[model samples]
Target: MTDATLTQTGREPRSAGALIGRRLLRWGLYALLCLFALYYLLPLFVMLTTSLKSLEEIRTGSLVALPREVTFDAWGKAWSGACTGIQCEGLRPFFWNSVMMAVPGVLLSTLIGALNGYIFAQWRFRGANLFFAFLLFGCFIPFQVVLLPMARMLGIFGLAGTIPGLIFVHTIYGLGFTTLFFRNYYVTIPHELVRAAKIDGAGFFRIFWSIFLPLSLPIAVVTIIWQFTQIWNDFLFGVSFSSAGSQPITVALNNIVNSTTGVKEYNVDMAAAIIAGLPTLFVYIVAGKYFIRGLTAGSVKG
Candidate 1:
């Protein structure tokens, strides 16, 4: 028999009946996915419409109904004029506070993690595994368990209630996870490159800076996104480690959302929530491409 005939007989390629069933299954799956999308997006749509509507409209109409009249005044007020505590200057200052805290925390933690990972990956001395074990253990330790000690330490350094203190807190807590990210990712990288660079008379930092750092893009994206999101959205650390004018956006939003002594301004509250969230959302939307790369970058062992 010819090879084509033999193949067709042995494997009886999918029949018309099977193909029709598969097409039906696929369309059914697509319909389910569309339903799931609407399920999640419905709340967001309601919030957007409510935020744009006037107080009277919100009071008189259905919560999920589309706004009859849209206005951007609530957005403007949320940005620059809303009351977040006694400070009636809006969420801008707190927003900047979060930006300042998150940026430095992410940078410091990521750099330290890269160095620690390189050390663990390349230069193993005696007791290295033991030390690395302890370091990894930090990743699982609950922050609440150490809060008192951390507060005392901050006070000792006169960093209590300061921006620097908040940065230090985030960096310290963030290090273990970032280190794990880089360490696991780097293990998949071949050590032959390091050996080759060493043969060229490159020192440790020289080889790392020139050779490995360039290839660190995928893991770096993962690290930055992880750290930025954690630090930006942290309410506990923001409230605990910082106070007054130095609180991050999360803390400010909480105060505004829960404030007493006024008729509840639901529209402003929704707008403020959106403003507080937009930065991290923007970051994710912009760098989401890197997230996919990061997930798969360490899959292959070379």
Candidate 2:
């Protein structure tokens, strides 16, 4: 079009070149993203293929090849029949152990943290910052640093080499982070609510139950998801605190996968790994929206 018509329409032939370049750049970014996605996803593809393949196919074929014949045999074995040690029974019990450990661990930790966060965020006691700082201090200390002390304490409590010991360890370790999450999230809550509750003769638990707890749902979800995943996947605490029968899924999975015996069951190992991971994956998928909201809530400007 002529310059007059171009000006009238807010269009230019020269601008078409710029538009084409923009399109090319956008496509280039998309291509880069796709490449990265494939790079990260390649292992999952391999694991699925390997899990479905027979031992012979895995040994003879490419690692990334589609299974010659799909089989649920490995999945079944991984779930109910694979040997972790002298025990030929599969991951079922250990999975339950994880469930048992994770459920109470998440609940108790999050509950105490919610209370602690309320005390830290809303209750302005003297030395509160110092106490909160002490709590934060726990988060920085590595588990290995406290491992000996924790082990000794568990032993003293007669909880060593038991599932409860693992639960206790996870709850204590997790309290630091969960408290932090709720504290930061609660900081964003307006003080007017707390003041109004006090004026209405509400006590600490009353204010928390009535005014804060409902508002804390987003952060509670984040805390539960975080604690659940961490406790479920923890290998160190499980290995140190749990014996053969009491071991969590992680330790059991290790024993099963690394059992130096007659045959290396790659298919079974892959299937077991998937089974071990499914809970955390499912949690992330289901509550992921609340997770994002919880993370962003603390950062919002009043």
Candidate 3:
């Protein structure tokens, strides 16, 4: 064989071996990731299976085992019939309570944040940085620190222990986060847009409504997801600020899980936990990709 032919033939085996090694490494990584996914998902799997089981079957079977006979009685009870203390009313009312509070809270905070972001990013007024710094400070305040003052404010407003009260509280608390998100995102937009709008005699509100708001979808998604998840899952504020009737589903779920009145209904507890968690889960499942995209979109400038 020619020398070139021999050299070419000799390289083939090494190349093939390298390719095989890469394939094996890739498959190993995939397997490792799958194992980790299963490990993290184990609790949710157990909760779903346990919720489907009869108490007798749960006692008899392994914790990780699938149900012998599937039933949604626990789900039904959790939604409408489960007892929390003296009240047997399930999570229905409280679920609606959360929806009412979260929807308005997310909208209000996002809208106000968008406006604040617009001003901070493009308006460039005096003392803007100082005010923005104060907002940044607000973001770091702990939930416990605001409990007393916020409670007193709610009392003064006569909104104590009401759904609207919860809405107001979440909106106010979420403002810092929403404003920060929008400000960072808005900074990424060219300032020329605002200037061009101003040249067209567009007033502040007009320019924001016509130009900025339309381009706000990405950061808005991020802000909405953040606020909704926070507000929906909040237990401290829900419990501390609301009466029994106005409590959010998180509080109700806690009540259901901790209720000591009867033969501990493990199935109902699991189901209730899942129910309380479903909205946020659904939100994440649907908008999770958008959330990542939005975060990356704003990350370039801020």
TM-score of each: 0.91, 0.93, 0.91
lDDT of 2 by residue, 168-232 (tens): 99999999999999898888778887898889999999999987887888899999999999899
Q: Is candidate 1 or candidate 2 better by TM-score?
A: 2
Q: Candidates' lDDT values, in order?
A: 0.86, 0.89, 0.89
Residue pair clashes in candidate 2: none
What tens-digit string does per-residue lDDT give for candidate 3 at 1-302?
Answer: 11121112233445777867866766676677778888898999999999999988988899999999999999999999998888998899889999998999999999999999888988889999999999999899999999999999999999999999999999998989998999998888888777888899999999999988888888899999999999999999999999988989999999988885757888989999999999999999988998999988853441
Instruction: Kindly give the stretch of ten consecutive residues in candidate 1 with the minimal lDDT sum.
Output: 1-10
Q: For model 3, give the 10-residue run with minimal summed lDDT.
A: 1-10
RMSD in Å for model 3: 6.8
Best by TM-score: 2
TM-score leaderboard ranking: 2, 1, 3
**What value of lDDT does candidate 1 attain over all alpha carbons?**
0.86
Q: What's the number of clashes in each of the models? A: 0, 0, 0
- Output the better candidate (1/2) by lDDT: 2
| Model 1, TM vs. native | 0.91
